[model samples]
Target chain A: MTDGDVMRRGDFSNGWKKSFQSLEKWAWRTAVDAAVLLALAAALAAGVNAWKLRGGGSGGLPWAGDWDSYVESKALAAGIGIVTMRELADRVPSAVLDARPRELYRAGHVPGAWPCPAGDVDASLAEHVADLDPAAPVAVYCDGAACADSLEVALELKARGFARVGLYPGGWSEWTANGGAVETGETEAAP
Target chain B: MRRALRIVLLLARLALAGVFLWAAWGKIAAPDAFALAVYRYRILPSWAVNAFALWLPWIEVLAALALLAPGRRWRAAGAALAAGMLAAFTAAYAAALARGLSIACGCFTLRADAAAGGWTTLARNAALFALAAAVFADAFFDRRRRTPSPENP
Candidate 1:
């Protein structure tokens, strides 16, 4: 090759090297920045969630992932009929039981749900759900699929000779996720 | 003309920032609902859904703030993150649509509605991606223009 050609080749090789270095630098810096931003976000989110928990704003997110699981398998094992959002909307159960804390129920719950938290199912049932006809189709739900309170309530209803017991696996979380209208405040506390 | 282009880019970037803040607000207010929305996407495992919901809004907020940072590096990084999220969302939407799943987009609101997850969402995401690309490209080219070439220097 001519002298000029040799110089051009060297220049081209150098340019390639420089370009590769620039790309490597850009990737490295961007990754570091993204990681740092992610860590900062995680820390901030943790703080906010902790604060929400303290104030009871987050409700009871006892289980994450499969939040709509309704502990479906458990409900099935107990011979409880499954309820989908579609079916719930179509039928609109005669009685809807909110198997969550009174505060969470007050904060935001399925419309027409009567609070019958898991801790005092018997008392809650007697106090809140006693008036409803057990023979009528009743739907039970709680925070989300991860919650077992709905199943507990459903099973309890069956034992109490409730003829029609259906379990809404999706629960409040699913309801909100599906854009269902939520009713806040007390739902006429039992006297 | 260059000044006009710069102004357009600036406004677009700001608009993106506003959208991000708005989206983050809904999610932050209703963490449970957001988590359920994420679960409905069905892309992530149940174990990871809550964590994703908890931290994703924060990431969006930080990225939006970075877009407004004074430094070029921060702005570029922020755009990169935003672009990455949009690309992932675009793909997810496409996949879900392909599978014939009609769910809420959860793009902005925590409350999942039937109206959100239409084919139009893909178009919206594409537009947002273009905005992010413009911001990122501005930072990338600005870097190259400011730095002297090794051979010349």
Candidate 2:
């Protein structure tokens, strides 16, 4: 080949080398940008969730719990201090927390029950009773003795530094059966 | 034909990203409930449930963002990640079905009321998996064509 042709070929090789370098740079930039964006998106989502858990955002039902298995062991462990409807009525525990779903609470709950559904009790409790005195008496119940959610809430409360959490295992069924005062409306606390 | 193929791939990428983002929001909003739903699957170890519940949604958001990011490499990586996720989901669903363990899919909603079991969930995952694979393949081919070609030069 002529010297001119070789020189032209050398230029072409250099051009390809430059192109490859730019391509590598572009790939690296895209990768870093993508990683940053992804991290930002994740952080934002986690922050919002944390805010909701802390009662900063308007509350909504997290979801339903159709797959839950009512275990007898949970019921036994949950019955740490079972309260009767009579006792609950006569004493008027510091807080009456309904562990049923928000729909159930809205349908009808103990007149002053705080709707702390078991589906997302960790968040609901923060939303409903974040400021309640943990040392004070708290009563939790679910749909009925058949429903194990109340026990779950009671256990959660105890774990959260609640000093005197009680389980009313008979739940809504028992309460309504005994002609207890019932209120139906939004699940929020009374004015 | 190439142009049409590119359009279809772009649409597929957007749809996958949208679905992932939507799914991530619900799960992220209710991690505790999601964790419980995961536990019901009885697949992962007990301790892993909470951590998975906490991290999976975030990873999904990340993957979705990566899928729509501007660049073939990012999109391809994202598609591969998405494909991996769908495969994991399909396997979990299959395992649940094989064991006859009736449970919720916990896909879009954390609600346990919507018990998603059986072949339908598996089919849905399979379809999603196919789409992700297509996106990955398309991205791979597109990147190859864009690369410096000796003969073309």
Candidate 3:
């Protein structure tokens, strides 16, 4: 019989009956297989993705790989150098850009550091940059390696046409670790 | 064997429906979290994510309900819809994996903290896909068996 003829004979009600009849035969095995196969596929996919993201290339997305290259190039053009806490202290004349929150900065900071929180860097950097020479080195730091505020502030500086934005990746923890000079009295909070 | 298959089919249907319902409720209740999850994937445009956040849950709920219904056509249609959703989710998950982004999976919520990563999410989706495939396969095979022989014709 033709496909159309078969369907016509069964119609909707009969079709349901037929479908259920087969369900009686293989429901358990089919359900088990379906569940197992799906679970396996999902697990494999999740594992691979997690690895790739943590691998890190300019924010973890593969398509955005060129971002690191861009950041590096900008860093070079801006004469920004990422220095360790010791290196930053050795260069006493440099200005420090504290990228932590205003409250943290007010509580304590590197002796010469200015309170420029990371979130406000893009907006506030212009006024500060206007006062300083673009070629003059500026050091940026936050809490520590676990924190990303410093990197973000550095990127913001780079974007704002400032060429000399140094990132102190070790940040405040490192400064304290290395016995760098710190000022404890409350500093004015950044607006 | 037929009886066993029927039990399996029923279980599969219920499981798939349950997942859809859970996911639908999640997205509907916490759209912002879902939107953020979509944003993290970085696939869809911001505008599209907003629109999807509004509508996707209802579609999922309806499809789940249809799949659980007894009508053959409704079951088939629901299976198709479920399969399509599963396929889309699979592709998105695969892409996210390739990109190496550890994003909160906004499957049920728009909150970043609510996101899950690693194998569990993938396994969950894969299980759903398999259920959809089984439903379709069962329907197809059942129809074939019910057909009369040429000699009878």
List each candidate's DockQ score: 0.37, 0.15, 0.05
The number of the candidate with the highest lDDT is 1
Model 2 misplacement above 4 A:
A1-191, B148-153
Q: What is the per-residue lDDT of model 1 for residues A79-100, given as tens digits with 9 covering 90 to 100?
A: 6766656656664578788888
User: What fnat does each of the candidate structures reach?
Assistant: 0.51, 0.09, 0.00
Each model's number of backbone clashes?
3, 3, 31
Interface root-mean-square deviation, each candidate: 5.7, 11.7, 14.8
Candidate 2 residue lDDT tens string, A17-52: 675565456455445654665566557655765677
Residue range A92-177, candidate 3, lDDT tens digits: 32567888998898788987677788788755566444477666677888887567777778878777776767876557885776
Candidate 2 CAPRI category: incorrect
- Model 1 stretches with alpha carbons more than 4 Å out: A1-16, A56-191, B112-116, B147-153
lDDT by residue for model 2 over B40-70, one digit each (tens)? Answer: 5777765566656766777788778778978
- TM-score of chain A, model number 3: 0.53
- Encode model 3's per-residue lDDT on B65-127: one tens digit a residue: 767878544565567668778988877887888776555566754432233465677887788
Model 2: per-residue Cα lDDT at residue A26: 48
Ranked by lDDT, the better of candidates 1 and 2 is 1
